[model samples]
Target: MQTCKILQDISALQVLSINISRRCFYTTTTTSPLPWLFVGLGNPGEKYQGTRHNVGFDMIDVLAKSHGISMDRVHCKAIFGQGLISDVPVFLAKPQTYMNLSGESAGPLAAYYKLPLSRIVAFFDDMNLPCGVLRLQDKGGNGRHKGVRSLIHHFRGNSEFARLRIGIGRPPGQMDPKAFLLQKFNATARERIDVGLQEGVGALKLLASRGLTESARCFNKEQKYKHIRVQTLET
Candidate 1:
């Protein structure tokens, strides 16, 4: 009788251990949804406003206004705001660490939020693309953009973060690229950029509601075909 009682107690203990193990497995495998981080790269200061290089900053402003995300706080070396888009939490940041050192702000924001690279999207100017054109890409090399280079460096060499590349076009003949970047767009280009910003807001909303892949597929296709027509007209 004593041996039988001991066996029954042992069996109970084993069952309890199995239940605990199952709970642990469930806790480890299940995760809540993570927020998205949208970072705009540009130099901060009144002087840089409206310049080609500051399009990223302009984009942030447009997004904040459209979504009612108040960028009224300074955090992680950036002008920061948080709000919901389609009930999904989203963070918007404009790095105040200047363009080349954007990572100083971006890296800490990601770490603080414990976000993966896939959940982060950066907005910045791209000279390789024609003015008024935009590109959304999941991952790529920095393409010699200083702000992007800094981000890659701070991400521990990880370059998998998505980007919304706003085109400002290349410098015209014999003009210094640096000089052009700091120049305000002429009237024609300014009109194009304004139109582009509105379009960008739509694309971003789609991104938040649907997802990166779907948003990119729809946005990029329209932009590609539209730009092709524009180029043909100019030529």
Candidate 2:
């Protein structure tokens, strides 16, 4: 998973701003206004696909399917597509820089499109809640998430952007959280994830129509009553 190497690189560049490789992520034919940039965080390659850590990627796939987003172009170290959601133009991205350097892929894309931090929505897995429970927060601290910490650093310490948090539950027994993130979901977990992903699809639509506050309130309220178990992560 290159997890060790990513950790080393993060430490080396902890205080330094390094040049990132350029990628051609944009090929939009939209004459309409740019819709919100929805970035799904995950590692690249087959081993990572369908794993708990790739829930963001899975959500991107769901959104693209429901909204006709092709995700045909690879740029900025991500594969993305432009499509309309209920008449709103939106860009979907799945970053290819593993997981720890997601900010490197997202920051440049934001600059490329001249989009403000407020216009971006980051969707990633969260370990705090049971599987299938989602948290929609306007802004908050990274809670020590390494990928999110990287984004905060790259954004010049700004953490005001919108976030769509999907719960993946905690590790079982004493298993390493890192290992848990890479493992694919079990059958029972997948059954529940399908439900959560449907909610996530609805949540994204709500974000496009309703503002962030209303959307968060609409989705987060369900978590209080629903007791679900699932696995996912965003580090």
RMSD (Cα, Å) for all candidates, in order, is: 6.3, 15.2
lDDT at 121, model 1? 94
Off-target runs (Cα >4 Å) in candidate 1 are: 1-32
User: Candidate 2: lDDT of 8?
Assistant: 86
Model 2, global lDDT: 0.81
lDDT of 2 by residue, 1-235 (tens): 6999999889877534332212213332435444689988888999888898899899899989988779899978889898777667688999888789999988888888778888888888888878878888888888767777767777788998888887788899999999999999999777767788888888879878866788878887876556432222332
lDDT of 1 by residue, 125-173 (tens): 9998778889888999999999999999999999999999999989999
| Cα TM-score of candidate 1 | 0.86
Clashes of 2: 3
In model 2, the Cα lDDT at residue 48 comes to: 89
In terms of lDDT, model 1 sits at 0.91
- Model 2: pairs clashing at backbone N, Cα or C within 3 Å: 25-75, 131-230, 168-232
Residue 200 CA error for candidate 1 (Å)? 1.1
